[model samples]
Target: MSDYDYVIVGAGAAGCVLAYRLSQDPANRVLLIEAGGGDGHPFIHMPKGLGKILFNPRFLWPFMTEPEAVSNDTGESWARGRVLGGSSAVNGMVWVHGEAANYDRLAELAGADWSWTHIRQAYCELEGHQLGDGPARGGKGPLRISLSDYRSRLTEAMVAAGVAMGLKRAEDVNDPEDGERVGYAPRTIWRGRRQSAATAFLRPARRRPNLTIVTGVTVDRVAVENGRTTGVEGRKDGAAARYTAAKEVLLCAGTIASPAILQRSGIGPAASLRSLGIPVVRDLPAVGANLREHRGIVMQWKVDDRLSQNRDYRGVGLVRSVLRYFAQHKGPMAGGAYDMGAWFKTRPELPIPDGQLLMSPYSFDYGAPSLRVEPSGGFNICVYKLRPDSQGSILIRSRDPADPPVIHARYASDESDRASIPVLVRYARRYVAQAPLRDMVIAETRPGPEFETDAQIFEAYRRFGYGNYHACGTCRMGSDEDAVVDGALNVRGVQGLRVVDASVFPFMLAGNTQAPVMAIAWRAADIVLRESR
Candidate 1:
């Protein structure tokens, strides 16, 4: 058995950063464990190569949700990364910091120092964006940011369309002080490769003698005695191993895994854990509750332009595209499927924006197991109900660590969420059919022009919908007794144990969570540092 000052689980986005910052002291020994292999996949680096693993189980958790009553005929499958850098290694590298109100809400709910002002600074300190150019956005940080080298006629048309429609293009999307702005999404990519957290933080920190990274290891649960965490018990290569935490134990296994780990350790809903024959450590009802994610539906259309990825991927053209990427790291193959989008209010009368529109110059066939490629050019416009009213949870289905959790996403359960989908979908159709882009539309692949009725559109939403894959709020932070973690990111009832990940989000942010998760770990490191003092 080995011991360290800090034992962090799940070397995903948060764990990687924690390991990097904690080991800066050289004196502090940090042990990090991951259930997945290291981030060495070819697709893990190429921005567009992600399409290769989108549906593959090689780098994914392959966790599917229970049947959604209102949405699709088939239940949605939740794809999470099992590798180092976790979802960051596998996700669509669109980097977003979320609206300021998102953090303001967390500060109010979690109490003190978590406000937008406090959290925004952490975002700046950890990430450096190319769009920011210099000081306005974070620069000189470990994470790399860049613009896509290739462009499609549809992408050019969409931006021109937005400009034509009285919408302003923002030079910087991550600007906290600037009001609403829509622009090309800046990605976590360096040159042409994905700049995953493992790539930005972990790989560089591994050289430190103070840090030890263990992969292909599964954590059973935290070993708690007398209400204090002693260490963790887990399995590595079919061998049982136990390690003690000299100073603290942090659970960065994400929303689903964090709560599942807590429940297995007897620290969740009392009745639920009791049924599992586990002694209760706390009666935190909100442990696995408050689960929310962005629900998106895509509408695709065929095009005749020379700019579509379809043109670049067809036979001889694909070989040229691959060769270009290999040589200069610049080509259509190096670009992401999506190129532009906007964050806006669902209803003009609403107090704030509640939806996001993502536009892409490539069509992805959802019905197929692999990415859908077409001989004719195609593009997609996706609508997402960003601030959802519906809620669900993740729970332990069995005591086995390998067993997947019972995930009830409950998408569209709320009537508001259900109603918002069609309106947004219709709006997406309107955007596609209106000026600039209207002339380019040869035909609609999903919910074609005839599906005008709300019921029809709702059905289309069910048929074409896929999760934005931004799951959060499982081990929520709150000041209330029912909250799983406190403002400091510490487990409510457990001593010397904390959870630092998307799981600690009291409410899901208004946009993509990758940067926000990095920000949380940035602040968490400070919290851990201060507490240690």
Candidate 2:
């Protein structure tokens, strides 16, 4: 049997970083386990490959949400990456740090360690930004955050329109203290490749003798003896295996799998464990509670001007673009899913941005399950509630580790979330009516011309809205009675075990979760190392 000082349960964002940092000391041994295969797929490195892996069975997990009641009443795809980097490998690479106030809020909820001040220091040390280096940004760090080289006139016009509406231009969206987050953004892409956590943190540490990287390992449960996590039990190549953690078994299985794993291991709600025929180790109802996702809906338009990326994504141009990506690393394929976006409050008096508006110079064919761009040049503006009051969950259906969970997203459930839908939609519609876009814009394809009233917009949201893929707070962090993890992120009612992924987020961010997750992983590393063996 193989054993290590630290057994990280997933080779995702936080797990990879922990493997790298913990193995930094020559005496410490680390075992990094991954359920997915090697990161050899070409789709993983391309910035625009999100469309390729969004529905791919090999890259995406088989899990999805349960039918909702309030929102679409349908099971929207919960695209968690079954790869080395986790969702970061398949994400759009939008590197948003979120509002400082949001981090401050999380700090208040979890602990002082999660404060914006400490998080700011972690961000400064963990990122390697392309723009330059200083207190506001990282100069020489493992992760790469760079501005996209691809810029289309339509996206430029979208920015111009937002500016015309009196929105302040942000110098850099990734800048922490930047007064305005309402503008175009610099993404987390390196050169022409995607900067996933696997690429940024894991790759550099792979050669360490103390760090053992194992793939095709499905960790089913954490071996708990007398309420302390001793190790992890799983399967590899259809053969059962178990590995002990000398220090701690870190569950970085992400927002969805982390809680499910806990449930399967008998550490979750007693009812859930009994239903699965698993003996309850700890009766924690908070294991899968407080789940939240940023609510989003798209507004598409068919522009008279054929300036969108839709043209480049079809027919011969598609093949040519692939070749161009391999040859020059500068083409339509080098950019991320989004081109420009802005964060603003529905009501200006709010402390932080409660709404987000992202624009792309292309629309997709959502009529089918596949992600296909439109045949003609069209544009899409995605509006979302950055801080929705609604919460959702991911609960296991059976004792089988391979079984998908019952995800109840209940999107836009709260009165506040429902009320903000129209405001966000109307803001995008107004932005589209501004100078640059109004002149070339033809017609609204989605929510159509009839959705003028707030009620109509609410219906549109229910008909088409989906999660922003920022599902978090499942294994909530805090010292509260309902908290699954304590202030130090250690799983409540269990010793020698901890959660260090997006699942432990005390609350949701005002923007994307990638950048914040990295910073959190960096801080988690510090906390883990301070322990005496």
lDDT of each: 0.81, 0.83
* TM-score, model 1 to reference: 0.96
C-alpha TM-scores of all predictions: 0.96, 0.97
Q: Candidate 2 on 1-533: residue-level lDDT in tens?
A: 43788899888878888888899998988998999987778888988777877768897787778877655677878888888998889888888887777778887788888888888888888888887686557878898887756667777788888788767776577556534355667677888898888999988999889999888988899999887888999999999989998778999999999999999999888987797799999999989888888868888998754688887787888899989999977788888878787877667677666777887888887785667787777899888877667888778998888888898887777888888888889888888999987887888888798988988888888888877788888999986877999878898889999999999886776478888887888888888888644
Q: Can you give the lDDT of residue 431 in candidate 2?
A: 84
How far out, in Å, is residue 11 in model 1?
Answer: 0.8
lDDT of 1 by residue, 326-351 (tens): 88877876776567767666566755
- The lDDT, on a scale of 0 to 1, for candidate 1 is 0.81
Cα misplacement distance, residue 188 of candidate 2 (Å): 2.1
Candidate 2 TM-score, C-alpha based: 0.97
Best by TM-score: 2
RMSD of 1: 1.8
